[model samples]
Target: MFDLLIQYEWMRNALYAGVIIGFISPLVGVYLVVRRLSLIADALAHVTLSGVAAGLLMQKEVAWFQGVNPLYTGMFFSLAGSMFVEKVRSLYRSYQELAIPILLSGGIGLGVVLISAADGFNVDIAGYLFGSILAVDEGELTLIAGIGILVVLFFLFFYKEMFALSFDEEHAVLTGISRKIINLLFMLVVALVIAASIRVVGILLVSALMTIPVAASLQFTNSFRQTLIWSVVFSQLAVFSGLFAAYYLDWASGGTIVLVSVAILLLILAVKRIVRIFRRNPVS
Candidate 1:
């Protein structure tokens, strides 16, 4: 199985991209989860699907677009969607959560229309919807690497501000943190992560990679830093194991990865339950 990496360029690219996404998704997800903004990832992912469909449609009808990558278009849409969400949220201050569902519905509707227009691209579209290990190419790997670096830098420079905001928005604002600017930048970063991860986990399942590992880490972690560390560890474990299972079992890579993360979460819950019971009974 390990030999596949050295023997096939696609395999190597998938591995590299998966590792980068595995780390960064959870890195950003920690803050989102703490702030109860996990749904934003799902919304951006649906918007990205529309962009991908648009790219596919152009490729079919336009000569110049034949050489363009759909992932680029998907990234553009994801970023645009993020900005829209922020704008809408501002307009509905008392009902800010409404922004996510509105965008999610609009994105899905637009994506369906674009996909219908493209027609005859079921196979290619499936790759974007459910993920294909073979779909990743060298160009996409470079894009993923660049986005990964940008996410890292954003976190490094604004770690404290992000932390403060996540735990207590009101106090953070009083402390002079620029909520509006930070939030806009954070949404953009989330969009980038969703776009970069589409090849590894697809648009439909990308949010799972971002949130599930953080969910698992929260079970045992006592500190914010600990949650971040454990989330990355669990995410890497899921990515590597899920890729191996997908390769050997011929399963959808996105589904397999999500199932592994879910399995990890269940396992942690079971262990915690058993420990609680043991603590109550002790050794007679």
Candidate 2:
């Protein structure tokens, strides 16, 4: 199964997409977890689903969209949805989390309508739900790679500011970090990451790719930067293992990946408990 990367273009594209998502998802996800805004990824992913559904429905109904890729539309709507969330958050500052549920519901509603219009779900749409080994084409691999680079560069450039905002928004504001601008930019970056990851992880489970590894990492890390590093490490482990399982065992890639992530988190908790018990009762 591993050797297929050299033998098939589809396998190579899958590997590339997985690695890109492995790196960026947890990298950005660490900050999201710290800020207690992890649900935002789920909301944006649902929005992306609407866009993807629209693209698929259009391909079926309109002649022009036959040649168009659904991922492009997914990215556009994800970005727009991120901005909408930001606006709604500002409108109800005392209840900021309301925005995520609102967007999530709206996205799911739109996606259902579009999918129904396209005559219900088919194999092509199933790929976006549970993921497919061959779902990503050459162009999408290139786009995912490009988006990975941009996300890394932006994260590095705004590392300190992001940290400040994540840990203490009031302090970030006091430090003149331009919280509004940085937050909007971060949301946009996160939206792009979600759109890019859906090719491999699928829309429904992509949030797990973002948050589960971070949850596991928090069990072992003492510092914020260290947490980010561990999250990416655990993410790579899940991605690689899940990809291997999906390829050889005929499993649904998204579900396999998320279940692997959950397994890792549980393993980490068990390990930490054992270590604490051992320290408390050192042998003679």
Candidate 3:
């Protein structure tokens, strides 16, 4: 695999794109878990799937769309889906969680129709669903890297506001943070992260990249800042290890990555339980 990295440009592209996603997904994921909107990532990823399917359909039927990239459409629809989520949540304030399932079902329904319209699922769409090393081309690497930078810059400038909002929206508002603008902008950021991530992790499993690292981190940390730092650590570890495994073992890249994440989460859970038992009994 290391030799492949030196020999193949595609290998480098996959590794680069995967690293960026490994970092950005969990970076935004902390806020998602803290805000209790982890499923929002799932909904947005599905909507992005609709967009990707649309792009693929157009690529087959439209001359203009043949020149266009699916990621662009995926990003647009994901952003639109984010706005719709906010709108629906506001409409049903008593049932904000309702937004998730509604968008998810709609996205799946739309994606299926578009995919079927394009003459059934092809290898191209399957790559988006499960991920592929060959799919992480130079263009995708650049696009995802650019979005990753934007996401990092957004948090750098708005970390305090995001932190405040995540911990307590009421307090953030009381502190005179413009809740409306921040909320909208935050949704866009999430949309961008989801769209960028789908290339390497696939739409079906991208939310796991966003969520699993944070879940593992929470097993070991109580501080918000520490949680963010550790989430990045665990995410990077999973991405590198999974990439290596995928390259050498001929496994599905996205599934391998997600399975590594799940293994880390379970290990953390077991360790925490053992620690609790040890603390209760005391070491002889």
Candidate 4:
């Protein structure tokens, strides 16, 4: 099974892309979860799907776009969607959450239209929708690596500010943190993560990678920093195990990865429950 990496360039690219996405997705997810903005990832992912469909359509119909990577177009759309989300959120201060669903619906509608126009890309589109172990290429792996580096640097520079903003937006603002600027930049980062992660986890399941590990980590971790560390640990574990299983069992890579994360979450919940029960009725 392990020999597949040595034999196939696609497998190696998938593994490399998975590792980078596994690390960065949860890193940003921790912040989103803390801020109670998890749904934004889902919205951006849908928007990315539209961009991907558009790219596929253009590639088939226009010679100039034949060599372009759909992932780049997906990134462009995801970023544009993020900015629109922020703008819409500002317009409805009392109903800010409405922004997510609006974009989500619009994204799906546009994606369906574009996909219909493309007409015969079911196989290629399936890879984007559900992730394919063979869909990642050398160029995509490099793009994922670049995105990983950008995410790390963004966190390194803004860690303190993000921490403050996540835990208490009102106080952070009172202390002179620029909520608007920070939020816009954070959304952009999330868009990038979603676009990059789609190749490993697919557009539909990408949010799971971003949120589920963080959810599990919060169960036992006592501090924000510890939670962040454990989230990445759990994510890596899921990616490794999921990829192995996907390879051996011939399952969809995205579904396999998300199910593995879900399994981890369930196991954590069960353990926590048993511990609580034991604490209530100490060994007699």
* Candidate 2 RMSD computed on C-alpha atoms after optimal superposition onto the true structure: 1.3
RMSD of candidates 1 onward, in order: 1.2, 1.3, 1.3, 1.3
How does candidate 4 score on lDDT? 0.91
TM-score of each: 0.97, 0.96, 0.96, 0.96
Scanning candidate 3 in windows of ten residues, the lowest lDDT window is: 116-125
Among the numbered candidates, top TM-score falls to 1
lDDT digits (tens) for residues 99-187 of candidate 2:
88998999999999988877875547778876774567899999899999999999889999999898889988998899999999999
lDDT digits (tens) for residues 1-284 of candidate 4: 57888999888898888889999999999998987889999999999999999998898899999899999999999999999999998999889889899989999999999988877674468889887755788999998999999999999989999999999999999999999998899999999999999888889998999999999999999999999999999999988877887778878888888999999999999999999999999999
CA lDDT of every candidate: 0.91, 0.89, 0.89, 0.91
At residue 5, candidate 4 shows an lDDT of 81
Model 1 alpha-carbon drift over 4 Å, by segment:
none
Clashing pairs in 4: none
**Cα lDDT for residue 1, candidate 2:** 67
Which 10-residue span in candidate 4 carries the lowest summed lDDT?
117-126
